[model samples]
Target: MLGIFDDLAAGNLAGVTESLARDVIYENPAGEQYAALPDSGVWRGREAVVEAFRRRAQLVDVLELQQRDVVAEGDRALVVTYQRIRHLLTGAEAGYEASALLSLDDEGLVRYWRVLSESAAEADVFDSDLDERLLAAVRAGDSREVGALLRRGADPNHRETATGLTTLQTAAGLGEATVVAALVAAGGDVHSADSRAGGTALHKAVQRGDLRTIRVLVEAGAFVDAVAPTTGHTPLMDALWYKWPDVVAYLLERNAGLGLHTHYGFSLREHFEYELNVNTRGKDKLLVAEQLLQTRTREDERAAGEQRLMAAVTEGDQAAVRGLLASGAAVDERFPVLNGFNDLHTPLLVASRDGHTEIVRLLLDAGADVNATEPTFGAVPLHKAVYNGHADITRILVERPGIDLDFQGATNGYSPLHDALWHGYEECARVLMAAGARTDLVGHDGKTPLDVATESFGAEHPLVRELAALG
Candidate 1:
């Protein structure tokens, strides 16, 4: 009976099946759920018992097994064993400590068996030096050495000295999938919570948008809805923060539950809206935020949608420009109450500064004043484009019929050509020149294009040479 228990622990299915009585019954937990034996159900008969063991084998490769304790009385035996099971594809291993009760008939063939496995604390396998070696291997991304050391009886769930991070948590936090896979292959506790943050590897993968790592963790049976301690943020929150739409979709597909909320009293969707509005300010940020908000909510979802759109136009999302216009979003939406960093500019001025040509075209097409000046810069779209060296957009703006080419803003006495030449935009200068920009124009510095070019780049540079050759 003791020998039969040893064979079963070793995953020697054939030996166990041969030794068991025809009426033997075996019981264990359901597949991929837990390690405990089924409470009520039992597999009856030798062939049925063999099939049960085979099904359990399919979940993980039994790399090694060692009996820690065994006691026998007559034909019955009880044994405790530590076993390592490796994930076939990722090579990640999970360790379990299990106790099995075996009953044998008069023929010395096992007749009944039940096994119960449970999770253990990290201190069970701690060795001071082995701990350091594992941490170093994980930090350096040394997958091979990590795997070998774990195989040599090193603990996969060893905690670091300073940070107290389990190897899995540290490796996953750094986005080192190789180290993570090796640790998992070595029977590391994938569900081990980080000492500091209480988040798991799955949380780390979600935060960084490492989709491959997420897939690996998930396939290794990591808890999908594992939440961080500090923020109570779930993997979904991490995905949304990093803008990983595909990861969000994948987690959702995996039946990941979503009661995730921040300490600020906001859900993941609301958090996304807040981040899109406040964290992102520039033109591109606003546009992406607008689209992102739409993905999370409906059109009549006014609070977030309106706020995002206002921020969008203020930052210059071209599609938002068209969408707002079509949907009657306020064109002159002002932020007078919140004055610091909240000064409002028309969408056209925002488009000009960011060099969003399509947005500029949309605003113009939607009846925006092309010559409207931003309050601070006092520069119109042409002045903004020329100042920023937006050569193509400047060309487009100047080429518009009935547009004022010589439009002078209040801040600078210089025309569009003066701004172009001062900014060293040779291509813009050429375009302005081709558009009949004045060669004799003088700026606030009392210098022409040739003078500025010669002073800035020396007469030998192409810019100065082009200006000098223009004569």
Candidate 2:
């Protein structure tokens, strides 16, 4: 019995049962008087005793329990305990006294345990009225009274019978950010889901299109991507379904999943697509079909603008390129046909290959990837500039941040310098060499840049002489 108490004091439930016999019996004097108490005051067998203790734990949060008169002689012992416990729901605290009688088995494990505490029966516990009062205060928007009720220990996680929504969910759905914060402060479970649909507080906030409430719930540790079990709808999906573009944008900014599918065969759109002749207003209740379509419209417009920007870049039209870029053209537009400018490469690659140095500068400043490659030869902008003898473009390309100076082409394995030397572009080769391009890196035919240079121009060639000098 002493060992059991010591284990329990150490917050070890497994250790508490170490000294209990398999057939242990437990009796509490107040069990018959308290309907909330388990086992009607008498629990037989070790499992039943443990379950009854667990039920008692739910009813009261024991802060401290000290024991006295712990007399053990032979096979019997009497232990007197004074406990300070807090009511689970009401948060009221009080002190109570109890006495336990235990008999030891042959192995020194407790075979029988009996506790006498009639006052424990009257302790405060789960109250439906208090829960309703908190719910009422929330519904009434009486944040002050709601805070007062929470201070009085109203269970913040109480589930509503009719709606299956927790108190926090209900408050969140009503756009009551202050009330949500108060409930969370009072031990409200931000992750608790509704019993009916398994939607959490954040989902409820999305339904209301209340970013304030959503932020409050999130700040309180609510999961941003918690999916509703019954609907398979994340908070972001819920925001899209409700036609709340502001909420949708906020969720997207927070990195919400865009490629998620619902349980009822509804797939969330990953990117905006233009619908030819159909209305976006949803016919079914599960989705609103509004914000996603609207957002797709904006994306389509931006895509058209980007196509114009690509056309301007291809034509070397500096003014048109500047205007389109200022109006928001993505630095790397991956579209196939851009305003009739058919190309399999990016703006920077086209600009560099065509010797449009100003356009190349614009694209670079607009955040184009310096190492972006073309699909045809798998050659980067540097390869294009050096192979085409664009010495100025080669200089700019090498000077750009994150440029791979020694990157070998995927197809021919020629570094930028090798491509320049293989094409007899001494000026581009000089620019590459001055930028510290490695001369020893080999190409696809197992020939170094120097070997390619010697093959292109004789060893008497000054470029070849420079390569040999570097060696």
Candidate 3:
């Protein structure tokens, strides 16, 4: 039995023929390879079996085969083998554990063999037991329990798959100082941002206005100047946005990056000034404004560089982009646009919308937010690129790491995928789907990207076919 399995695994078809009887019967289940090769099933003779293997070789490549366990009783042996196969044309991989039943004749020659299929694929297997336990401990704020679990081999950086929130982040937001410490000591990732908002545990602490928890996290060495994933709002900006005077002062004292800009192009100092001017609150507002503006003189030195970068980006000048970045301009500098000229004007967004692929790469390399949304309508660079029918730019944005592919714009909650299909950008839609864009994301009008594609192009259209394939 082992010799037969080895012969097949080594591509020794002639050796396999010598082992089998001249009139041996070999059979693969219906639909095993019939979709690609009709003559692959049920071979009557040893020569026919060899022909079936030859046809199968044309369709797929067996990447791996592992013997699991074998049982032998009388003249029969049951052998389990795990096989990983990759399709030649589509490059799709499927792994399954197969049980082969063999009946042997005298002289250790195989007469008949039958292979059974497994119900589950290797890729579909996942063990989330430890993750569930870690989440439960963190959520319950049981520091001792969490510490024990971590020591017992639970992942300190385990994230809730749906929300992408880490255990430390959850504890920080819930003001569980002890749990936060336990997680941090266990090597919890302090830098990972939540998938949805792109904010770190520090941001979560600020959102809850928990100063003690914030102190615990800061002492644990969180990134003080960490920006939100989608909006690029720093901890200081988050404190100001929520009107937490004490938290704002704490962050400012820690030298939180003073000039970081929001997705809407508002700086922390500028946001404070805007709030001061809008409200009638007297002393507190005046004090916060004075403290924040103390660093204005330093920011003024970079003002000229920012202006040049913004001008070059608006014009889609790749050369200017390279020069300005080298001249100390912040990579994600935002400038106020004229009224009715769009709310956000970051270099990346502008270059992407203008279909400047080179400039887009330069800005992304300079740490521009690929998923940063415009403050007015909450559209990211991907949305702008798709709306303008820049298929190349769309492909680049979708391939970027940490890009929110299914983010719904504030305009109508329509994702970039929906925008691409709605505008008839068939190539852009294909690129997005290929990069794992969620086709079932429903917009405000309760329509998926597929629905929009089907409505714009018929069901048989390429766009519809691509989306249907994703399903």
Write the residue-wise lDDT of candidate 2 on 1-471 in tens digits: 586776655556677667778999888764223543443477888787777767666666667778867887889988887767666666767776768888989998888988755454334433324687799999999998898678656898999989999999999999998899999989989999999999999999999988899888888877667889898889977776676767777765564655567787766553122221242564332233455445644664575564787778878999998888898977787544222333447888888888899999999998999998765478899998988899999999899888999988888899999999999999999998888999999888999989999999998998899999888
For model 1 the local lDDT of residue 432 reads: 83
Among these predicted structures, which one has the highest lDDT? Answer: 2
The lDDT of model 3 is 0.75
By lDDT: ranked, best first = 2, 3, 1
C-alpha TM-score for every candidate: 0.34, 0.36, 0.37
Q: What are the per-residue Cα lDDT tens digits for candidate 1 across 1-471?
A: 566556755778888777989999877644422322213247899888788777656545567688889898878788898777664433555677778888888888888888655443211322224556667887788887777567656687877657767878788877887777777887878788878877888887777767778888989989777777788787877776776777777776664544346876997667777766675444354455446435433422343345554567556677767887788765544322111233345666666666888777776776766676654445677887888988878877877776677766666567777787777787887788788866666766677768876765677988677666777
Ranking by TM-score: 3, 2, 1
Question: Each prediction's Cα RMSD?
Answer: 21.9, 16.1, 19.7
Runs off by more than 4 Å, candidate 1? 1-128, 281-471
Which regions of candidate 3 fall more than 4 Å away from where they truly are?
Answer: 1-176, 179-212, 215-246, 250-289, 293-307, 317-319, 322-346, 357-384, 392-419, 430-452, 455-462, 465-471
In model 2, which regions exceed 4 Å deviation? Answer: 1-306, 337-342
Which candidate, 2 or 3, would have the higher TM-score against the true structure? 3
Worst 10 residues of 3 by lDDT: 119-128
